[model samples]
Target: MVPTIEMTTTWERTCELDDLEPGWGEVALLGARQVALVRVGGEEVYAVDHHDPHTGAPVMARGIVGSRGDRPTIASPLHKQVYDLGTGACFTDASLALRTYRTRVVGGMIEVELDA
Candidate 1:
């Protein structure tokens, strides 16, 4: 049997890193999905679904950027539901979860790896 090779071509370029403001979230369109690109500090970035799981509203980009202890978090602007930026786990509601995407910065450009 031949060895299978993993491909890293799923990463899609979204926007320039300079376009994002630190401690704020920006909305980016990746194909048919709306992703929220969040910039923390300087180089640290995270990508999560722009849709709020609780209200089904595409307003996550306006969510407040904050932290719960060491874990980075975003609080929904509507109901103030907190979610982990790393794991997309809902801290306020155990039953709700936001989708997370892998993000990387290359040559000052931000790329997001969407789920297949």
Candidate 2:
């Protein structure tokens, strides 16, 4: 007998534009992965791991949304570790970095590309 193969896609639509407000963060559960989505400047959308790499806590969705220069960032509520929303690099720690996902707005909905 032949074994069946399974294929998984990277990009997935998690929520609509209206589901999340500008300058705020929201949690999107992509299967077993928890993603934190944020709408910056009322236009650009960014997605990162819901778990804060420093604290290992799943509270990034409740973290503060702000920017450093032109790059958007989220400060971990637990330890106040600032992370770049674009590259998921920790500003203060510099040794650790969060995981960032590719996000895009399509038809007023947000789509995140999960890494395999």
Candidate 3:
């Protein structure tokens, strides 16, 4: 017999889908952590850490939202370091990485799945 582990996901409601403006970022408080919510188009949404890893500043919510080819990206407001919105991978630097959280929309509300 093989042993299996079950994984559970807890999605916390952050805000309404209409609350986020396209091509802009919004800050959402997930408990004590600050999360940056970016809405690319009408339905596509992404959630990432609001902290800027390079500057140690919680200002990612004010970062510029754009795209690198097909991948959506956010550039830090302080240093202009670009990061992939979907994977939190730094495009300008390889050593630094921004944390990302899973997000979904339910009943016209945005929800985020925090890491446990």
**Tens-digit lDDT track of model 1 for 1-116:** 99997755489999999999999999998889999999997879999999999999999999999999999999999999999999999998999999999889999999999755
Query: How well is each residue in 43-106 modelled by candidate 2, as lDDT tens digits?
Result: 5899999998987899999999998998889999898999999999988998989999998888
Residue range 75-100, candidate 3, lDDT tens digits: 99999999999999999999999999
TM-score of each: 0.91, 0.89, 0.92
Q: Candidates' lDDT values, in order?
A: 0.93, 0.90, 0.94
Which window of 10 residues has the lowest lDDT sum in candidate 3? 3-12
- For candidate 3, the per-residue lDDT at 49 reads 94
Q: State in Å the error of residue 62, model 2.
A: 0.7
- In candidate 2 the C-alpha lDDT for residue 56 amounts to 89
Model 3 misplaced stretches (Cα beyond 4 Å): 1-8
Model 1 Cα shift for residue 95 (angstroms): 0.4
How do all the candidates rank in terms of TM-score, highest first?
3, 1, 2
Off by over 4 Å in 1: 1-9
